[model samples]
Target chain A: MISPDHFQALFDPRGIVVAGASTHPGKFGFVALHNILSCGYRGEVFATNRERAEVLGRPTVADLTEIPHGKADLVFVCTPATSNPEVLRQAASVGIKAAFIASAGYGESGEAGLELQLQLVEIANELNMVIVGPNGQGLVSTPSSLCAQIVAPYPPAGSIGIASQSGNFVSSFMNLSRQSGVGISRAISVGNAAQVGILDMLEYFADDPKTSVGLVYAEGISDGREFANRLEKVCQRMPVVILKGGASGLGARAAASHTGSLATDDRVFEGLCRQVGATRASSVAEAFDIAAAFSTLPAPRGPRLAVVTTVGGWGVLAADAISSTSLELVHLPADLRDTLDGLLPPRWSRNNPIDLAGGETKDTVPAVLDAVVGHEEIDATLVLGMGIQSNQGRLEREGPFYPDHGLERIVAFHDRQDSRYADVALAASIAADKPVLIASELAIGDPNNAAVAAVRATGHYCFASAERAVIAMHRLYERTVWLESFGEPNNERH
Target chain B: MSRTLSESDSKDLLAKYGIPFLPEVLISQADHVEDALVGMTGPYAVKLCGPNISHKSERGLVRLDINGVDAVRQACHELFDEARPEDGATGVLVAPMATGLREFIAGVSVDPVFGPTIVFGVGGVLAEAIADVTVRLAPLRRYDAMDMLGSLRSRSLLETFRGEPAVDLEALADLLCSLSDAAVGIDGLESIDVNPVMIVNGLPVALDALVEFSDVEVEP
Candidate 1:
């Protein structure tokens, strides 16, 4: 296992030196160097190579021996595997605690390469240093002035922390996080995991005050016992979302040869995850998606959910998803049903779905939202809006509800009159503090794009299709219910 | 990691788990092989039982069908000569000869995926050559073992094949269930193989058995 300090150094470097940094677009070193500078990192940056007198017009050294020792905190060994061991040795000799070998070669090749990779491990152990990878793109730190040569740049620093085995997947996740308005505290691509393992990163983030959620992308783990034990401890502190590959046989074999991971007898690992509070994701997308949701949404009060929608079709779809999952739709009492029946016209469906019909304005939508959320049994609310289709529709329909069409205007009016009604629906949810996901049936405007843009802009929970919203709601409900039964108090990191 | 259990050890282990084993005994010397044979009925069998001798038939360490003393004596000498001290063979097992119209093999092995698993197959070298076996998680129920037995391609042998009475499947299931239970109960145990268990007149009998365990854990 890697110490918390070592793992933190990779993501929170006080000073950085890219050994092979350059400004040339074609060279990997140059691309990495330019990305770090462009991300606006305020730290000492140095690029070195034997051939170049300077890199990206910054002072470059021929080698580590040329640079004044002890000044560089973390060294990015942006060279081939054959050249990395020597760099690690030189860095270690000069008291550099961490090195990110952003080069490719060794173990990932074949037997001969594996043998060479083992030698690198021996040198790292002897030096008491941690090596990220001989085949990694590198790592990123959102809270610090650090860019350890990770392939992609992410959003401004926030709480979610991600550690992954595939650099490409990490880069893709960063792209998604950026587009969705989700922020990340740090992300590390532990390629091949030849030196540092998953538990190392888990431990680091478990104690990290900035990180509220942790996501791990792994093909398989090396030490099952160690992995389970450490994760059990860490999960008690914060949520650790795991996205495991090798769910199939051929993929399992590939994972083993790729990273020397044990891929058999998955039940032991499964049992461990169930015993601990950690959540398991079926794919890479769910890992980050759920992490982002958990980061923004408050914990749900109960699995009981109510869907308030202007579109009857989407309301039915959301109800179906909610039912299929752990959350149950609370049956309205006779008096509450009578209350809802009097508010909407006879054409409206008066079930738990609470549809407000097509001609209803945004004011009428929130009125129905109040009745549904007001149900004492309701734990969370899924308010469905179709104005997602037209920007003009949002102005024309909801604009009347707001005096000046300002966010504060909407918030203030919501607090004064509609807030009371909406609160009755959201009371138990607010008191229990469950998240309400407000979404659109389908965009009426540019149907294809704005619907997606609307949900992404809110930075709240949204599924691509209405059916997915149900599944997410139900899954979230089931998860929240299970957590209530299993949760221990005062263990949260932030 | 691999060691053969003596007859008493084998039978005791199986019987404790409710698996039936024919009466048998292990003697240290060839002299005792004859005496042990006398206590049994007319039909008897003699085997060279040793810790190191894993493949008994391949090494010609087994001899069957001895009607009297002379045959028992000659079989013992031939078996003992085949398993000389140089072969690192242990002692010989003399027990009541188990003759059957049907034969089958059952085994339990530690699979890396599902842990202890029970495997059943058609008996003899031919079945092993074809690798005609089905495996399931261990500590098996009788129905699970029966299901595994019925799944084999050569399952017809387990029936009343060629007018021979049907092999007692109930007895086979019991044996398999018992073996699976033993495997689950015994940690650090590696493998157990019971091959060519004779089903005489539809009644099964263990002709030979082998058990092995690790002193230290081996990587799965």
Candidate 2:
């Protein structure tokens, strides 16, 4: 029954204390201390370590008792798992509102760990205090510019908020967010989730004004009906992306004891996702990429796509990618077909991939992009950067630019650098609103480097292959459609 | 939307829906059975009925193929005399025997995911063992009733299994459809179970049925 306003205490705190903080590098406590400082939090920040009087040049207390204020709005218990009980008991005596247990090796270890976790939960309940996790990475706030962990950088301050169970996976995801340029509003690691579980966080984020797109990295979920209902309500207004690990049996058990989560038959979750319009990603990378695209891109009008390339073979390969996804290689409209036919030599594939055959100039790239992207039927556009490089190189071999102008002057001033083509593609991306994928054949494994990076620098997609790009683009389209179509609580329309 | 009526309420509910039921009296105590027997026809069945009691046949609440006042009087006393009153007791039910029946089972339930549903199958032990049942979304159409009847693996029961005459399946389908229709129409209905829906010769009749109500506010 609690709404967004009630959840403010968890995300926005007036004061924060990083217990067990240190100046030492590579330690979890030190990393957490550094992250809190880096997030630009204006609130009161305190650090405590047994040995040091100062940590990262900030004044450190000998223990919780040394803080002059005598109390904190939130306490981050970053000590060993075994020491958490005593630390929590001491903190509770002073009426600490919330404490995040960033210690690992709790219920996830075995029966002994589970008993310890249960004891911690009982302690928190008795003291009327809230514990975030017994084995959690802690929480981050991009809107408030507050991060509680040292393992990763804050996501680029966007509307999407993520809650994950696996700290390592979530940390990696946060790192990936930096690489991909996808920002987040909040990313919380609810490890073990002994006191505050996914349901509580989900309800918090569902009504959270800062979050327009939601991502959950879950091992499993309990209370299927309640989760389904709550998510269905949230999905109507925001896209809720889900990545569930442990498709196998052993993983299912680990998932359960880690968070007291229910892992039902896999198909049940699949069916539920389909019914509720939640985007389900198979892997961590896919989850971030899909979440990235969904949060950043506009809704595509249709599934029809146009692949514009400078090479015929690259065009054929790009077309092949559409076979796996829902996207269709629509027939080029007659006017645009005629336009490409007139611009290219008769040898060019009149159909698509308008192979410039190395004869097309830098200016021609933008022109062709404009023609393809402006076509009414095209849902998205993919430009092959490798095709531009090889084809334009071939054209250079067959002709001289000018006899009047010197070769150095012509090459330096007029011809433009090899990477300029990426800029033109990026411009088309901005105009199209559809995902513009720049494919690099030379860098087969990591196409987003150099040439593809050239395009992505302009804020477009840089994929390894046309097929992968098409799949990503199609899934993004489906996610947008789903976000638009979901029902609002009891007022289900369809 | 499927509404369930208690045994006494079920009889009244079904009769109003045009389900032909045997004329009977619902006596609260064993002493009232002697008075109730005068109105009942000979060769009548005697049974105990209450809200808390379901599947009374297994509980020895039912006695069938009986004749004469002494047999009816004895069966009634046996049912009511041994009854435990503390078990959310409603009352005791006494009804005449429905003879010449080819038994079948009918019920209505509201599935959490799919909403109101109706169930049909063969009656008695075979129904439990084989579970030859069919389910249709409730407030069913005429075609849906036919579809449900045809769906069961023992659908041949509707068309003269052994020497039994082809139960008037069209008539039975109509009855099922009407019950589902009534269930949807009722305000407080939750679940309905009409077991041993006796098909006597060609005509169908209800031998026993039960209904459970929703938690709607009731006037005291």
Candidate 1 regions exceeding 4 Å error are A68-70, A93-95, A247-272, A333-343, A389-432, A440-459, A481-494, B1-185, B189-220
Q: What is model 2's DockQ versus the real complex?
A: 0.03
How much of the real interface does each model capture, measured as fnat?
0.00, 0.00
Best by lDDT: 2
Name the lDDT value of residue A461 in candidate 1.
36
CAPRI-style docking class of model 1 based on DockQ = incorrect
- Mind giving the per-residue lDDT tens digits that candidate 2 earns over A31-114? 888888887987788888888568788888767766545446678888887887877777766545678888877898999989
Q: Candidate 1's residue-wise lDDT over A362-467, tens digit each?
A: 4555555565666677766777654332444345445555444465454444333322333333343454456666554342233333434444454443444555
Name the lDDT value of residue A50 in candidate 2: 82
Give the per-residue lDDT of model 1 (tens digit) for B1-220: 3444544455566667766677777766666656676558867677777656666676777777777877777777777777656446466677787766666776666544445656666666565465556655566655556656765667778888777798777888888888888878866666666766778778777776665555445221
